[model samples]
Target: MIEETPQEVQVVEGVLLAHGIEPRTHWFEASTATALEAAAALGVDVGAIANSLVFRLDEEVIMIIASGAHRVDTHLLGEWLGGIVTRASADMVRRSTGQVVGGVSPVGHPERLRTLVDVSLGAYERVWVSAGHPHAVFPTTFEELLRLTGGTAALVARD
Candidate 1:
């Protein structure tokens, strides 16, 4: 079994520590790029995985931390944000967050992008977030997530 944390994850750890949170990076042999994969790898519910989805609206980058169990309703999100939202491209994801799509963290970016935390994620006592790597994840709470990203809690996904 191989175990190595990616440099992006290390950067995320530094950001977490700087914010006074102890970071614990967990790497699995199985791929954790998707909610199903990550949940299976960690033996946790899919909803407990926070998917950091990036959307592009003109010049603005919107990072939506959505529950893995649901899909983000772009229409609703756009209405809530009062801006049109489009799926971000791979290049845009890397350029904006300094990380790839599957491993984008809620924090530790080249710049702070606008973030929204899904209210559904708050149902879980502990949630897992990407640690800047496809095979890396870290534990965090809903409140901590909001604090870290200064994200507004909203119904980002349709029920």
Candidate 2:
């Protein structure tokens, strides 16, 4: 069972509420670092995991919400956005997202960052995304994610 709301959970709750989303956390025993492991532990499909990835595009901050079953096509994304897309360094991630690699959430960031949601995830009725903490996740519909984030739905990841 999860606590009512931990300190780290507060920000996530706030973000979800502000977005008019119904978010709840599910606790698990597996490491939240990788989708494959998380999926196995949770007994959920890999596609249900919405990975929060940070990428640097022309030195600007960009967030990508991709399906666990896929990997981002940075080169294609670069061409689509007219800029080079590369993985953000750990320092850049900390400075921009205020969360580590495995537990980055698309919302409640330290500051606002550009966002992109993978269109492939739209096929699912709902998707699971990490909260601010590893082992914590919440469910959100694809439409809600897109609306809340004001993110473009794109084929940014390869399935």
Candidate 3:
């Protein structure tokens, strides 16, 4: 049975289902706001955490599904995406994804935004991503994310 989902998470769940992916959101008593926190809660490697990050690329808003183990290098990300990349403001984040900073998901936006998938995420068989709520998360695989978002696989971080 599916857990009772908040409206925000329901939007994400619908998107996942529309893509033919079925996943249940796990709600935690504590916050899963950060990748480290989420990984700890799930008892998984940090690399298995998929951080859905929003960025302002030139005039467009984009999403980068990065692995939790490393930080995304905005400079390199811009070069790869062929645009100037900068961190989206709180307002921009909310406006673009209709989700807060800590609860952004790879899908379920008002419109389809350009997305990039960090290649490092492929190292793990399954990854956990925000489920449109800070206290909620859902399981997915790298290939599924790529397929769902129609994202490009790229090296988004620096060592």
Highest TM-score scorer: 1
Q: What TM-score fits each model?
A: 0.96, 0.91, 0.95
Candidate 3 error regions (>4 Å):
1-4
lDDT (10s digit) by residue, model 1, range 30-100: 88999999999999999999999999765688899999999999888888778788999999999999999
Q: Candidate 2 — which pairs collide?
A: none
State each model's CA lDDT, in order.
Answer: 0.91, 0.83, 0.90
Backbone collisions counted per model: 0, 0, 0
Off by over 4 Å in 1: 1-4
User: Which candidate, 2 or 3, would have the higher lDDT against the true structure?
Assistant: 3
Question: What range of 10 consecutive residues in model 1 has the weakest lDDT sum?
Answer: 1-10
* TM-score winner, 2 or 3: 3
> What ranking emerges by TM-score with the best candidate at the front?
1, 3, 2
